[model samples]
Target: MHNATSRELNVDVAIIGAGPAGLTAGYLLTKAGKSVAIIEKDETYVGGISRTVEHEGYRFDIGGHRFFSKSAAVVDLWNEILPDDFIQRPRMSRIYYEGKFYSYPLRAFEALSNLGILRSTACMASYLWYKAFPIKTVKSFEDWTTNQFGQKLYSIFFKTYTEKVWGMPCDEMSADWAAQRIKGLSLWSAVTDGLKRSLGLNKKPNDGMETKTLLETFRYPRQGPGMMWEAARDKIVATGKGQVIMGYGLEQLAADGEGGWRMSATNKDGDKVVVKAGHAISSAPMRELGARLHPLPETSWNGSNLKYRDFLTVALMVEGEDLFPDNWIYIHDSKVQVGRVQNFRSWSPEMIPDEKMACVGLEYFCFEGDGLWDMADADLVDLATTEMKTLGLLDPAKVKGGAVVRQEKAYPVYDEDYAANVAAMRGELEHKYQTLHLVGRNGMHRYNNQDHAMMTAMLTVENILAGERVYDIWCVNEDAEYHEAGDEGAEKALPAREQVSEDQAAALNSMRDVPERIVEADADETAADRRVA
Candidate 1:
């Protein structure tokens, strides 16, 4: 592969990573007439975690994500990209807790009544009992939920699932995750609201704030979330001032004394090019960016400080199967070790091949080298089949071909000491260069959902357009206490000199093409010859 041109091209912005964040930034900036280029290392289409995998006409999203953010800007962006594609569909999800299926959002009365009136009354009594005497210490996410809802309810509805997600004991995990996820929800609120409606009580909050039901109906793309980003990519590229360069891996970054940085990249096509950017906003993980920049100081803190967890999903092309009703299921049984399972067709019928068939993405979350990641492919299928059957999900026999996708650095883990170390590195990078800005989950070291990620990208680009020295990537999500409303008016803060100089903005753009480093240095589970448990 040869260089398209020996021209030393320079632009106002260069976005790293093509996920929702990077794509959203590119879309907004390009539309604003800022010349932009999105650099992605993967050979596949960009969506990052929200990306869709297409095999034999069957589509599988890396994780089960639906459109449900309260952010107006995010919603507006969604509408702008796929206005017609927004399908207001009902969500049918249940929790298989303690071998019983409980309606998610924990329909208090129904769940209690089903457990028998005695237990139902006890549940209500205990719930009221706990609320009357709230726990003073809100330790972990589990503690916060239990204190609010009661221990029994917490154990049943939240404990297992939360443990599966963070891979930590409920008591050990942070309450912040719970607050961001489930703090405002309550049985009392749901009951009073439902009873008022059942018995003609007070009017409800707007359709969005109906707490009893988290999302009675939600939005989804006809294809997958990728459908929205792909469209944005096309529009951005069509602008003629911007281009999304796929498979262009970042190799190194060399900064000129004048504040501009040069990026050397080796793309998938094996072509090498230097991207001279006026400003660079990266949506990839920050640790990876740190490693990619050569001139490896004989010492670095990123070695084991940051860890990447890989995601494995097997898209089962069943023999005309209707495996599960929910769009997804959380797996918490220790015996199985699978994090969650998704019913892709539940999001849309288009995810499957034929009208009569079904597609299930069995998700197994594992670190780089746990024994499970070292298994054979056939064993993996067998394990998945057995586990699904054990959990009463999949019948051991009705399966067909299995398509596996293993992703590394999927989730950024917040361990005991990660927060301080990540901040230290980011602090150094902030004063070190003008061209680089880390935006997405990995980049900012924040556990942001897809909407948050997208908003980060949008904000970064907004900074470029406004010529403002805006909030850094880390502050977008982690800085504020996130209410369910999402990061709405996050940019009110301003200093006397908030605008970036023209040369400062241009200096910021040239960090593209430097080989983006892959951090945590985990082994590639997908490449292993062995596949299953």
Candidate 2:
């Protein structure tokens, strides 16, 4: 356990975690000529959630996360790091609704037709009925979605897979989650969109909705989502403004007493070094962060405080043509243990050797010590292939090679108890560490996708550098609500949000004018920020 190093390096800012948030922040800090070092616990990988893995001749991502965000700044930042490698690719998504796949954005015609004429007519009738009455007491995510699209539509398009994603019944999950993710989405908008598309009066591409009704395209890295992070790492390090030290685990955090922070970390090569920094930014999980503080917690958190679930990925290399027209498929059969299947081969043919062969990742939701993660790699691969065949996604007769990788804390579960506890803990951290900022998916323990995670990372770095320390970084989750009895600090936090975006006017307009996005500003903050109230 005695890991030591004579390298003895220190920096002005020590970024903990090399995921999108850490990488982006470190890159920005370095670009600003601030001496920065990115210390990560895993030596083997630089891309955190976005990292790509190669097995034999096949390459796979835990999930094929596409790059598409309303945050153009983040998009430009990504392209700058991986310029020519960025390609505009069409995005195709759907829900495994009612035993049949339906368009994800819910195409008015296709969606109604998919439900079949009878059921579809009934749903439309219900939607009209709901429009008249509306949900007066919408609380949970399910309730909100049902309110917008009606209960029939919610059960078909939202219930099962949504349950699979969160590992919680839709009824139990917070409505804030739905509010944030589908903030501006409305059934009325969908109808308007479909009519416009039919009449060819759809909003022009440059007008801002990138393939609004169509969802025409998304920009993705040539290799995978990891490529963008890797490029950012390279650019930041090459600028001599940042240092990305992989295989370094945070060992200890002690105040330097002179107003900075002293961070001790262990690297993968069995070398340990203590770092000193003027400030610190963390993209690590809040749950582990609590225990990892200088003085350990007096007791492990009882369930009432914090809770999260983990995920597993089985990357299957199949010898076949296109598995499906989609870049991925949702395994909707409740009988299957897997939640989703990502066909990386569909991402790009060159990602694999030949069109004759393919690679896919079957995703399963599980806890850290769960039975799914306990299985051997080969066994897990076999199980994934079997389930894929059951769903007709993969033909077992053509499986070439398979590898499995299990990711712990892939998603932060949002149960009713999570909100209050996360708030209390985040408040304590913010008060205790002026320079410490928590960001990214696990960093704030919110169910944020890659784009949101990267956006969070970008904002965090900017907020600190801009001297906006009191900025609400915890509001990035889907389920954000007002937990305040009074609005003392809410009046004081205007400066931070103003500094976060160049187009503050547009952000405020879109946020304020949209009824669904009523709590949009706060929802984009970290879970810790919202729950602290």
Candidate 3:
């Protein structure tokens, strides 16, 4: 970390936000002998959405980060940074609906028994009906899901919990959201996966073969994800290659005439600090960053209009050695506003400071300044207690104490206008600011996982070092192939040698110098390969 007392400073790179993206860039750049400065608004936290919150003696992640990635580079990076601290954890989660807990991945017999013979029959019939008469035009999440899982199962499983998370009717939400999240998942696929998983066929750690939904195990930092970022921060500072300045909120930014950026920030005590850097990588929320620009571009309007979904977690300390066995459970019942519940002990036993007591986080999704967000912490804790008892997950009397954490702009809203707005903003930024690059979820206004965000940062660093846009960060999470592309995709149109066919390899070798990373990482996954394999 850098001393905030410095009134004026300069660096080779100025990064906004100390999240996964910013820290990854900082780590890689600093390791390559570049001077860097990371400016983070929050004085205490470093991982942004991936941070861990310590309340009293109990520690819990804001959003539990399962260190699983198809990208070999991302996986290798994780192993490089926090190898010793990583713990392999079994993945177990369930869906709580109507006072019953159904195993996630939808255990066949459990779901059947819980839904009863008649309702189960109805669900199968509905699935067949949808297969026979699928929706011609699937515009909304409801429509898309109904077509895939049938109306009965969609209503029984997806509808209520999804609505609680997005705070909108399923019909009002975009189908793109569903498509991006559950692209290959269908009723038959889920059933087959569930049965296979039950038989221990997909129990291995993610090795690129298992779909994300079927993964039975994952890695996690022993202390929490923050352990990784905190280590990265210390390593960068120790190497004297970078300085991470905390509590410095960016106030204004302008392009320096000398092919760089001049950034002004306000420190915790209201002191202003100025920095001049040759390049800047921003992971700040697009909306917030747009408001801080000097001589703002035309895309500022679109940036300002970008919407975000906020989240709050109420950590309840209960008097018990055992809670529910699952790492987390989706609260599918519409009766309660709590969207999900997480048992910290299930994530990692070390997460709880006390062996005799269990810590659980009741997660609620809501808009900033809305009823749930504005509710008092005490009331929110009470609500969690009541809901836990109502769901039969815990007893209200056993609740010892609680704490609350509210995260604003936790998720970028994927609405009707988001794509157009983001495109405009991205176009203007790329054209106007040669030295400025946007990376990460809030930075790009894209809903991506931690590894995906890290992949963007890794590519951004490569681009900076190569003195050009050598990689397209946008393609990181587009598909399995992109994730598998790794360093090979940093320079070529095709994947690593063994993953591509001879013709594809020849095509890549013959291609002219492309400005950005290959957009089609999956360009070689031909139908013939699937059939042959």
- Highest TM-score, which number? 3
List model 1 lDDT by residue over 20-101, tens digit each.
Answer: 8888888888888888877888877888888888988889888877776545667777888888977766677666644566
Predicted structure with the largest lDDT when compared to the true one: 3
- After superposition, the stretches of candidate 1 with alpha carbons farther than 4 Å from their true spots are 1-9, 108-156, 174-213, 268-270, 294-304, 470-475, 478-533
Worst lDDT window (10 residues) for model 3?
Answer: 510-519
lDDT per residue as tens, model 3, 380-494: 9999999988888888888999999999998887665677888888888888876799999899987777877887888788779979875666655523223222232233322
- Judge candidate 3 against the unseen true structure and give its global Cα lDDT, from 0 to 1: 0.78
Of candidates 3 and 1, the better by lDDT: 3
Q: Rate the local accuracy (lDDT) of all candidates.
A: 0.67, 0.67, 0.78
The estimated TM-scores of all candidates read 0.76, 0.76, 0.82
Question: Going through the candidates in order, what is the number of backbone clashes in each?
Answer: 28, 18, 0
Error of 3 at 310 (Å): 1.2
The lDDT, on a scale of 0 to 1, for candidate 1 is 0.67
Comparison by TM-score, 2 against 3, better one: 3
